[model samples]
Target: MGGNELPLQRIEPVSVSGRGLPRWLRRTSGPVALVLLWHILSVTGVLPSEVLAGPSTVLSSAATLIETGELQEAMWVSLSRALTGLAIGGSIGVTLAVIAGLFRLGEDLVDATMQMMRTVPNVALIPLLIIWFGIGEAPKIALIALGTAFPLYLNVYAGIRNVDQSLIEVGRTLGLSRLAMIVNVVLPGALPSALVGLRYSLGIAWLALVFGEQINATAGIGYLMANAREFFQTDVIVVCLVVYALLGLGVDFTVRTLEKVFLSWRPAFNGT
Candidate 1:
């Protein structure tokens, strides 16, 4: 090869199979394969229906529930509980985080107490909650709120603390007021970590809801599962489980979308 000319190099052709498929389909391939395997096991009697229903049966049961409007009502109740809990818990967490993160006195008063409380398992409080609030919606919502609060509190506090001191210096140099510095510089810097906390809290909220609803729930996915358990309706149970999983996934996706929108200016490393 001439010094001035680039040397000829071999280039590998892209695989036709991979290139032909959509990205979404490729991402879902593992789940699809698992479903296929599940179907095979179910049909071959390797996996008993009593233990776990096949996907088809689960789908059929879900459709019937939807048709009868049972699933819709359950979903609405469950979602309302989860969202209400999240709102209440999120408010408390953020408020405490702000106080503890920004002021030494606040930290002294709040952080230690929160740290102590966080160590106690939220589920372990179920009995106390039931006694305090009864088996109605209050205990369940409170459980979810308690489960969610700590994660957000921890993450937001850490995020606020870990913010680059240089940025604070810049804000000071620019003569930004305390409130302005927090609103503009501190909050923006802490957002990514807060979003991570939100994702975690969202997952925990679902788990909490699951456990909470088991407390003599009259309506909700947990109630459906409980009712199904009595009748050995494996398919309905599976459907409820799937719904819980999907709801968690949906909230996580929503947070991710929010992160992308809010943190668009920040550069991140995409995997090779």
Candidate 2:
């Protein structure tokens, strides 16, 4: 053997097929399987159309609605309402959480009131909302805001408070001003938790939208579904439900992608 040469070892390429597919397809497998099973059951007459509409029937209904622009209009309304409410709620939540997390006096004044309101179910306030806001868009938007705020508040507060003392000390030692320390060290350190809160708040916003639109909306998916229910249009109802599920999944995927991008600086496996 040459003094500089080491023995060669053969290495086999690992098969990813055993894990089923690439990341995207793997993530979709469960929903695809469930859809296939649903189709099978529907075709086999195991599931009655009256009780539940199959994916095919719902797809057809959705296509019809889309062609007529009904679904598009309804979806736009719901999306606008949801986004508006989320913006309002998220801003309030982050502001309050930052205040309370950073200062003892702020916590004493604001945190307890928030905690009390958080314990009260947002849905339960619907009757009062209807009475106060008079079954208009205001009540619906308010409900969504209410639903979205609590989770963000809880998560953001926790995140800010949980920021490493060592980092804060280092920032101070480096002669960072209070605002500078918050912007650089505190906010960056608290970001993961804040993102988590954002994801959770988004979910709550969707749920709130669903409930809100069901109340007295002239348009929106919930209104369409409610109208369909009265006439026994199972496929349309299913379409509405499918839309909600897809929206939720899309939002979750967006947030997950954001997390991966923003948290790239952290080490993998609990940052160990």
Per-candidate TM-score against the hidden true structure: 0.92, 0.91
- Candidate 1 residue spans exceeding 4 A from truth: 1-22
The local lDDT score (0 to 100) that residue 147 gets in candidate 2 is 89
- List CA RMSD, all candidates: 4.1, 3.0
lDDT of each: 0.93, 0.90
Alpha-carbon lDDT of model 1: 0.93
**Error of model 1, residue 12, in angstroms:** 18
lDDT of 1 by residue, 47-109 (tens): 999899998999999999999999999998999999999999999998999899999999999
Best by lDDT: 1
lDDT of 2 by residue, 129-203 (tens): 999999879999999999888889999899999999999999999999999999999988889998999999889
Q: In candidate 1, which residue pairs get closer than 3 Å at backbone N, Cα or C atoms, i.e. clash?
A: none
